[model samples]
Target: MLRHQMTIVSETLMPADTAPSAAAVRSRVTVPLRFPDGYTATAEVLTFHGLADGKEHLLLALGAWEQALLDPEKLDPALPDAGPLVRLHSECLTGDVFGSQRCDCGPQLREAVEKISATGGFLLYLRQEGRGIGLYSKLDAYALQDTGLDTYEANVALGHGEDERDYTAAAQMLGALGATTVRLLTNNPDKAAQLTALGIGVTEQVPTEVHLSPANHAYLAAKRDHTAHTLDLAQPAVPSHDEMLARVDALIPRLRERAEETERIRRIPESTMEDLREAGVFRVLSPKAVGGFGMGVETYVEVVRRLGRGCPSTAWTVGHLIEHVWMLARWPRKVQDEVFADGAEPLAAATGAPVGQATKVPGGYSISGRWTFASGVMHSEWVLLAVQHGDVRLQCLVPISDVELLDVWHTAGLRGTGSNDVRAEELFVPAYRTLDWALLGAADNPGSRIHPDPIIHTPMATLLNLVAPAAALGAAEHAVEMFRERVLVRRVKNTLEDRQADSPLAQARFSHAYGLVATARLQWEEAIRVVTASYQRRPMTMTDHERAAYRLSLGLSGTASAEAVRVIMAGSGGSAHRLSNPLQRIQRDVDVLLNHPTLTLDPILEQAGRGLLGLGITVPSF
Candidate 1:
């Protein structure tokens, strides 16, 4: 059914103008193709003419591919089978041909061929190399990347759009082949959006497996952050920790820039929330079954710590929201299913002060309360509100729609957290959606039984206490860095020393601050190791002494972190104390964050002293 086009590039092999008035497609050749890895697929390679690009683009129709176009034009996703699972794979010369580890392009190509062959579809290989920026420019961008710029940043640095792809030709080719509706096999949202915009019906967006390697981690992260790509680096997929860190690292610069804006708005802006969601920050504690990363407690602390270096308010809110996922997991499986039916998604905030009261009903509880510190509520889909039910406290999970959000948070430090008041009036929460406070922190909780992942078995009470200190640690680190940079350039005002870098006092301050950061880091790591090690054991155990010790770690770390920031700020001179200076902000944030009960040194030391004397912990409920 192939036809010839009238347009000729050079001299026509057989001029369509002279002989044939035919279709745009001139050839459909079946070829048996084998790869070096012994993977084989019979490809019906196709060629088309009069393409808008005037390039010889390729199309390979895979297994039962004929059956795909054989169907009626419309796609019924509810049907047992629906496809032409098509992938409009853009060309990548270095990745596809030379086995470049810099990007996931090669793996994606190999995966697409095998997957499409199994289910039936077409792989349209468009010759838009480097995301339509050509090969030479892509390599040039790689050169820029060596200088520490991200892929997108490098592209912009090189006077090009972050992604210059245009899928108009892809749509035309699909239309020419009569594929009106297709299940798009792509991770890139732009691909689907562009195709849809160009009159092709995208029936479903089927995500691609994250083909993450050490070298391509940042490459994949850039795609996720710049464009909304569906890359869930869940377990057995990619090494989750490194991938998650890479994503967070990509966000730091942006977060630092938005620190002032975050404070001004008294909340994390909606865009920042999207950035966090895109970065997969909120999925660290959700179950893998629901498309979550299901990362461990130590990983959680590390992420929060990194986030603090950017914006402590954001870090504080995100930390609380992340912990809520674990809390959700502790509920009954039926409830967990309802909460996660969509996906392991963003911003589930919880306020745990028993400010709300719940009355036991026949099948549920009628709850009412004005809860404080409902962090991240602006971005939350669900809110876990702690309510007193008779003698015990119950965590009642309610949809965010049920609660009335009150914007009342005004503070000197961590102002962007928007830890506002949220009120629920006579809301009915089903019993299944509730978990007793006693069970939540227990190592042998329902989440452990329901989902036997080691993380599920974590003693969440301690984990909750420790999250704030991570932010403090990170802010302290940020302060150290900021002070270091300032020291090199700052002039010692009214002094003979040319710069602060030359002053002995400045040098001593820098050294002292650096040592405190190290101390804070050591303590944070030591404290968090307890969390990581707890999950690994079958029946995770932390004696009252151990719990006391954990608190001591947090207290010590928080103190060191706060002290580090103060030392840096003091030595940074009068300019450093200004409202405009980030150093002062860091000092304020670090100091305020350390005031949390878990980090307050007096009680922590007292508890540790008791533990050392074989005196039991005051709060030994877990």
Candidate 2:
């Protein structure tokens, strides 16, 4: 014997000081509500009277199809056995209708509807925009918020309470629907407490996840700290780069395990290479038109540096591979299409020194000679070899099938790179595959005309000089990590109460090493910023002085990185010098990278000094 009659909750409990006079009330009518997220629910719109200012406000009883099956003739008995989910949402047109980033109201509303639609629930859509101060007043409060006033203070400045919202109508609407108990969904505990005071049973208070962004961090923080909202404000929004870097960081441990194996095999492990490929490492510098990230030099350097922190050999190989893609973009449009046709991203190995000979032919050039230090030759499909073609220095692209790999990468450091010699004996290269080396530094190139990204227009020498140093920077950072982990705990052999990290001598050494690494990073970043700025200006051009300055920075960065590792090694004990320790390997790798002809300080300094002294430009490396 269930009753269909609606209950009349205590209206006498209304605040005696500010209770409104009773007015006419209207019956609810069922209507359909739909959302862009493909959720639909039936809503019963109820208009209430006796609100303040003689204004009418609406309440909505939202439910899914299963909830609609409840018999209206026996509403009480047909009510859900468990209390329904409920949300007392104040209307925020700015956040709800427009995706404003100032607050989390919009995301909360959307989340509430989605949850309610899935389970049986009610949404008391109260028309109390700006917490009852109205829309116009809320905008005024926003101006105060911009002037250093918090949300609550801004509301108080507008002559309103921190919160002026009343839940009496919400209680009455739930009584009309025969909902005695509800699971409240809200971050504010006050909402649940208010409902309980109105005789509605709040079974559970479910805290909503706060939506945080850079724009609303302060607002959310104030609410969490000052207003007692249950929110985890400690977590900052993760940047886009962090997602990529996290993947790289996770692989560092595994890379360390395979470091010795990689060097012994004279190549990266197949599994490690697969991991890098799956993580989209090689595609970072690929043109966007061909499904590449088309990222700038800053990101390029950062990625290489992070990878180097794992294994310098792998990082060195990856750096060159990515740089080769940038080089290919300077080739003719047909070559770019052929290389990236059908969304193909081919790994390429490149060497800038014009060490090969090329003879002119009918539609291309007959190339011959050996290009040394072709890193990652085993993994690359194409080889970009610099050749002397008559009077012009040309970068000729040939398929790996046309070139033979010679295992000659046996070096003191970066041995895992397998930077073997690539020999091409009389290979015919199409004219479209050859680009003048000088054109890469100029504003307009064949690929630049078709691929409009400014990254393609970057100076070739500036980009080339960055790869080796970036790997060195990563190795330097690894050295720091190793030193901190080992030196902090190692006890001095002969001295009592003395740890390596505690010794004044060791401290001075560590500080000096850290300073050098920090200076190198700053110098590298400044050079990259300058290059990026030039690329922004169409037809990217750099004066001889600017070019020489960049070259000087590159050399200095390498020197600093190598010197930092050396300094750290000097402080590291005999244990660190063991063949099994990574510090020794890092030292060897950095030394080898620093001694590179292009990265050497003297040649770069000479070029820069001549430019500064207004001497005739003899060096073309800049």
Candidate 3:
């Protein structure tokens, strides 16, 4: 049974003679938190002052967490204090703050808050989005999860390991919380080791288990297996791939329709986009330098996978837009100061296809040409028009006012993307505002010269390539949701057979699709994790490029999404083929996503295969 009381399992332990050191870290680095719709929050690091080599370090008064932010020592002045309840809860903007049903993190956080409030404990909520992988990868994972891989396996399939989180900073925060000993509220054992290694005493473990919803039971299992969490489960019997495909084949038509509806509306009416936004979807690519929530590339991949489960367009737009912001964030402070002189609402777009030109002027260059396939153009305050200048390709940021948007994004899929063409007539862009395209792709971007890190300058190609996979995964996830709703009441064809939901075949397909999403998500996250780690340590290297390639391989889950669509749609039969069927629309969306230049099968294969073979890859392929 789960206990609600504060039961002490061990005596308090504080390292004696370990006084707080005089070394001060300027914790007041200002991080500008950017929100969707362009709202900004100034995050001032209230604390970073600390001492001691691990054991009993202190960083008092961090972010204003639920008005729950308070100095731990102030709560209890007793010498060396009994310590606050140091909770290293991962950032789950949607569930914890907004209460989404997709996962248990939100509920668990609420429970922890209630417990901590009543019992006087400290909660250190790290800004680690999507388990430190990032939003894009998480969304991709969601798509894989829809395909039936367990959570751990899904991350792996997506090129990630089981878990990618660091607790050292969390430990520092704990010390700042005036916590010498803590009863951690967690199921993962790794948290315990991390804290202990950091020289903090984890006296007891407070188990915070969430009841599994039908939608997330497999997810829980994956966490237990892959992340080494303390959750227990009995593996179900494995079924053949043929049976799995047959099951999903039946539901495609309805899924296709639902996907189309989501895109046509520009917003998912059934689900709240606000919820996703709060989940840190829009901040995945934020740079650590600014006040934006910084997430590694691979983790972002997983974030997008999860969002994809709810709405593809939201995932796509958020993922693509954030990556663009990340690129801008790397610009020299002077450059950022100049461009952002008007504020951060500059609308920017990219046409992956090389097709524009610029002439060098005295102080800058005049750019003119028409570029298509620019996502988020409808809402951009700045535009990144790629143009050929002399011998090099450059990405010039032109004010939205200087560019004209052409509504040319008429298609049968991803309709809500609002991707249109941007036409400019000899617009003068300052030299500093222009990023050499070749340099940008070579991981030698001008922003990198300013920020000087591989993570910042890695080619836009590597990052942008993930958009289609996430979109496809999202389309497939809609199919799963639709199937779940209809399976119980709908009956399978044949001579008086069981309800479709009751069929073993249905269960198998649903479960399998779940795994695929999970696997894809894992792979995507792993890729970002590798990149982020490298960023935090030394600058990025060829290893980072390999990680990017791995991300591409996992993002190829569009293929799996397509397969899932085919199976689910076929299972629904001819009635689903009608244009009115949601499944048909999902199919069309998947088809469109597959054909997207980024998700183009041949290129992805070539890039990934070349990397695996240890061959040199082109500048932007990663």
Candidate 4:
């Protein structure tokens, strides 16, 4: 169906036909509105200037669908749309207004236009250059970019906040446009909270993810690490915790039994996947308006952690399902109706590593090529795949019917995950199924439209870490249980005249390891508490966000596991290294998880250091 159907005639630029009122301005600007059936009204440009930072700043405004969609420019309650599609965009003088390629401002702006143009949306373009620190400072940082400084460092060396953008002007602009609520499109969380503080309820966050390039790869990491942008290049699309656990509870025994079969076939049995469907695990994260559970992140995280107790692969798979659903939740209702009207589950898996292209077409784009490491393909009814569209990389969701799953999930660990290759030839994905890669990570992600919690707005990749720690914590707990029991009855050969538990060394090791695991558990709980606290508050501060990200990186990422391992190994003794021991598996799994890009020690240390010392930390090589 077509969206907004208003003609933006050039004459709309005429003044409001009234004398200057203290509260109103005779602004002149051209705007474009889209209609259903893929038709668009003639485009017109309107010049609207408003007070920003006590100075008049010019704004080129475009008006789209005003019914049922939140228009950020409108503030009157009576004229408000049923729901607002809010987008908080930072002013990019170099790219947005001027088409510069040094960054993704132009591409993001174009993508935002097309998306909002499709539906009724309010794009609040705040005049904060270079992520809020003006353009001159950005350029100055660029000049010093090669001298052992990341994007954040370069900005700091130039004497500027890592990010200095504010949103008061955006709120005022929304009020004037009769937009009361919004579905924000951004990766920056601070922007979302700021708009909410102004009484403009941000219903969702539309993500705008950008393509990775040699020029901006490191720059992107700075956004994720220092600025708290939420792109997870490692696992492009995955499920949330709630979805994963529900699937696991229903599929546990089946999966456990199927493990032997999985080993033989090197893939999860199709029947096991079917078992998950009957369980409703896949739909919990769907948009509530669409009849899905619409559970919050806290519930979802707990569910995944509980499942992690039995199997890490299962927990991981469940997380992937929920995150993918989180992405699907951001689609317009019309789109949502088409995808989930049947109330059937949509199983999706993604490979974070990008490799392929999606060529734009009339109604949508024709996506093709092979993508590897798709973990849940054996079970998925749909797949959200990452593809490159020219220099711009995008995420496209496709029905499983459109693609073929290749059996190639052989690995030393997580062997039963069935993470194989996904091959598709010219799969037609409607426009609604596609999302801009960079924008999705931005602070004001559109998915927050239905799920308003900022925790839901947290980066998709950062959420993936929850699974690793959940599994590690579970395994660690299990190992502790085993060690305690073994030492109670098992006698040390010639070295000790009594059971292992009677030895002072054994007692000391147990005490220490138990303390470490307990501490790690507390850390995980503390992190979850912090995140949940922000959810109740709705709008979090920059300091709160920084602390939350740090908690994830420092505590849950690897620090917790590192401490747990020391205790576990010390208490278990040399015999724990045997292949038959679960201790060996727990240690190996934790070790492998530590190598994850987000959880590694170097970046975590850097981030903690910067948070403590007022500096910036860049993502390090894993």
Tell me, by TM-score, which candidate is best: 1
lDDT of each: 0.80, 0.77, 0.61, 0.61
lDDT string, candidate 4, 1-622, tens digits: 0111121211132133321211123354566644322445433232244445653433333345444343424543654444555566677877666545457776676666666655555555666777677778888888887676888788778888766666666665555554555667787777778767655567776688664432455667677887677666441233556445555565555554554455456555666555655455565566554445566666666665655555556656766776676666654455556666445345577764656788889999998889887877777767878889988778887888788888777765566567889898888898888888765654456666646534446555445556666666665665677778988987887675479889888888888778877877777777667555654553432353455364554355356655666577766668888756656655665666566554566656656666656564443211
- Candidate 2 per-residue lDDT, tens place, 455-557, comes to 8777676677787888898889889878887768889787665578888788888889889999888777777777777767756776777777677777788
Better of 1 and 4 by lDDT: 1
In every candidate, how many clashes are there? 0, 0, 107, 71
**RMSD versus native structure for model 1:** 15.0
Candidate 4's displacement at residue 48, Å, is 87
Rank by lDDT (best first): 1, 2, 4, 3
| Tens-digit per-residue lDDT, 163-257, candidate 1 | 88887667666666666568899998889888777666678898888876546767787888778788865434424788889899889998999
Estimated TM-score for each candidate: 0.68, 0.61, 0.54, 0.53
> For model 3, how does the per-residue alpha-carbon lDDT over 133-252 read when each residue is reduced to its tens digit?
666887787788778776666677888866777776665555443354666778879999888876677777777765454346667767776667777543222223333323333333
Q: How do the candidates rank by TM-score, highest first? A: 1, 2, 3, 4
Maximum-lDDT candidate: 1
**C-alpha-based local distance difference test score of model 2:** 0.77
RMSD of 4: 24.2
Comparison by lDDT, 1 against 3, better one: 1
Error of 3 at 284 (Å): 2.8
- 546, model 4: CA deviation in Å? 1.9
